[model samples]
Target: MNKPVPPHAPLLEYYEAPAKRSDFVRNLFNRTAESYDGINAAFALGSGPWYRRRALRQAGLAPGARTLDVAIGTGLVAREAAAILGGTRDLVGLDLSEGMLAVARRQLGLTLVQARAEALPFADASFDFVSMGYALRHVADLSALFGEFRRVLRPGGRVLVLEIARPEGRLAHALLRGYMGAVVPALSRLSGRESATLMRYYWDTIEACVPPAEIIARLGEAGLAQVGCATELGMMRAYSARCPG
Candidate 1:
């Protein structure tokens, strides 16, 4: 069996055992759930919603497609998807955090399920498209997540994963590190210490995440074809692929 693709190396500062990762993440997100959207808007300079919608469109999300937004945090991506689908009737949002799901429930009229990305509760061939936004770095294993995405998708269904990647250019890397590492956390302090900690952890995960090539390869390994990645602003990546027909 191929080794699992962990999003990043474990941060010992947060938790001691790898098995404890889910608990740690759940607690952190629960603590920061209320302020998540505000912090994201401030960090993204208010471009998050527009960018998410455009990326979904670019990845071929269409009206009437049965879509599942995995790891859908606070409905940031799901809301945009609903707009494209003309309503929430064809959309479902799933996340591991109940607190995040609660916030998303209030914001979106779609079906919301509390679940992990690696183990979706739905039956096979349940969706035409699967999307995950920003929360790719939070999953325990990319292979399991992608496998579940493929299993839940009908033949020829598409998958789109949105993430923040470390830039290759020296200047771009430095600038992003400064803004995400220092500036965002500093601004998040207005919300609370947990929010600031979440932002800091967010940047750390981006910096430590596996490369895009690994992600693309793993998608292929998961039996998804036509895997490709589109980069925006040197830091944002939209990984797309399709289940074989």
Candidate 2:
């Protein structure tokens, strides 16, 4: 059997065992759900909305497309997608944390489901687009996640996955690490104690995440076609692929 494509190596500092990771992440997000959007806004410097919209549009999100926003924390990516689709009528949001889903329900009028990325509850060929934002590092297996993405997408459907990669330049890496590790967490204290911890854990995951090449390859291996990646500001990566007809 093939080994699982974990987004990051075991984060033993936060969870004692690999099997405990799902519970650890779910609980952490639940605790910080209320403050999640604010912390993201602070870290992204108010450019997240524009950036997400642009990425979605560039990846072929259009009006009338049925979209699924997996791991849709607080409706960040889903909101942008809804705008492009003209409304939330055609969009669905799914996440593992009910706390985050609560916040999303208040922010968006779409259907929300509490579910895991590896095991979507939807039927095959149900969506024209699939999106995941900033939560790739928290998944248990990229292969399983991508397979589900491919399964739920109709022919010619597009999948867009947004992630933050560690910068390749030494100076850039250090600067980003300093900002995310020290500065962001410090500012996040105003949100809550859990918010601060979440920010710190966020940076740790990015630093330890599997490389973009591995991610792209896994998407292709999952029977997706035209898999490619686009980067912005040297750190933000938008991975796009198409479901084969």
Candidate 3:
């Protein structure tokens, strides 16, 4: 059953200046890409790898399915998808940062194009599955990006969006806020980074993010079907939906 589309809202409303936020994110990853994996493992309490694998598997991927991984930061999820797809056909990666792509190429040995999530460079219905991990919040327009995602997927193709969100229960949310607002930055600082401001920005962005139900609703409103969501580690969510055939 199809649901009504919610009122559209500006994606950058949470930030006073979207470009500055974008630059901060890009530069943060560029600077810390070398140690990102280690940092994430520590930060997520060693659950990062399991989360990544679970996200990829829940997308209903197969050995030879066409896959497009957007925001392929260091290609962690892409590499997993590639390994699952077994090098058969239709594997591509896209991102806005060349440095991230370089790191991804070195790590995953897959070619990735530099591109924006809202404006992908691909023909209509080009892929069987599209996946993104921890990147949707940076896009300035949710509707535009979802539209592009739907446009690029073939009939019955699925889109998987994995992102961090504030924990739902009041107590959990409070603890998450404190950890993200305080502990994360402190840890980043302890790691000897020049600036831990990026962690602060990350918390703000995730807190401002739309909830999982909203994401599934938006995907359906954008011409997708069979929308569903799965939450992991209480705060991370993977939403999936299929393009109507």
Candidate 4:
């Protein structure tokens, strides 16, 4: 049975799905492109960049490796990975959002491509590392996206996906819900940025998203090996998987 579509998926809520998701997400990020990094920092309690760096390190990024950062909004993860990999590696950013990529270009001058994760415009076995940062819930199909990750990865390549998971304990869950659902939006509004809607959507999507076990199963189904998750503070999760030769 197909999983019922989550209510707060920006794509399903604002537009018809599967076809309109790409456009809706692209436009949504475009609308918040300039302030994305700031919004992320605010929402994640100023640890967003640190989390990206830690995730890349945990994913075993090597020096001089070819990396493709999918949904590389404003180059958040890509920037951290590049800096960690000595800032001279061949790194590129891909996304459906021109506005976001434009900000990334201005920020880092990376090779940015406007494309969808479900249909990556790259050759097979092209990259040693593939990373997507905090955009998993926005995808139309996790299976298809993970399959693309495997297709574009060379043998022995790794994939890292960072996402915000709902907290486990009742107190933690309540705090997380209040923080993301109310505090972040209030902060966004106070800051005079139009990202309050996006913040609310993020919290709802994170809370309604599939569990980590299902994500790991999909990674295996996509032919990825050594699938695992490193969860932090009972809320943030980094999924690490590898392509077998």
Q: Rate the local accuracy (lDDT) of all candidates.
A: 0.91, 0.94, 0.75, 0.83
lDDT of 4 by residue, 121-165 (tens): 999999999999889998878878898999999999999998888
Candidates sorted by TM-score, best first:
2, 1, 4, 3
**Over the stretch 120-208, how does candidate 2's per-residue lDDT look in tens digits?**
99999999999999999999999999999999999999999999999999999999999999999999999888999999999999999
The list of candidate 3 runs beyond 4 A from truth reads: 1-16, 45-47
Clashes of 2: 0
Measured on C-alpha atoms, candidate 4 has an lDDT of 0.83
Residues 157-180, model 3: lDDT tens digits: 888888887788999889888888
TM-score of every model?
A: 0.97, 0.98, 0.86, 0.91
Best by TM-score: 2
TM-score of 3: 0.86
Each candidate's clash count = 0, 0, 0, 0
- When summed lDDT is taken over every stretch of 10 residues in candidate 4, the lowest stretch is 2-11
Q: Give the range of the ten consecutive residues with the poorest summed lDDT in model 1.
A: 40-49
Give a tens-digit lDDT track for model 1, residues 84-181. Answer: 99999999999999999999999888898998899999999999999998888899999999999999999989899988889999999999899999
lDDT of 1 at 39: 89
In candidate 2, which residue ranges exceed 4 Å CA deviation?
Answer: 45-47
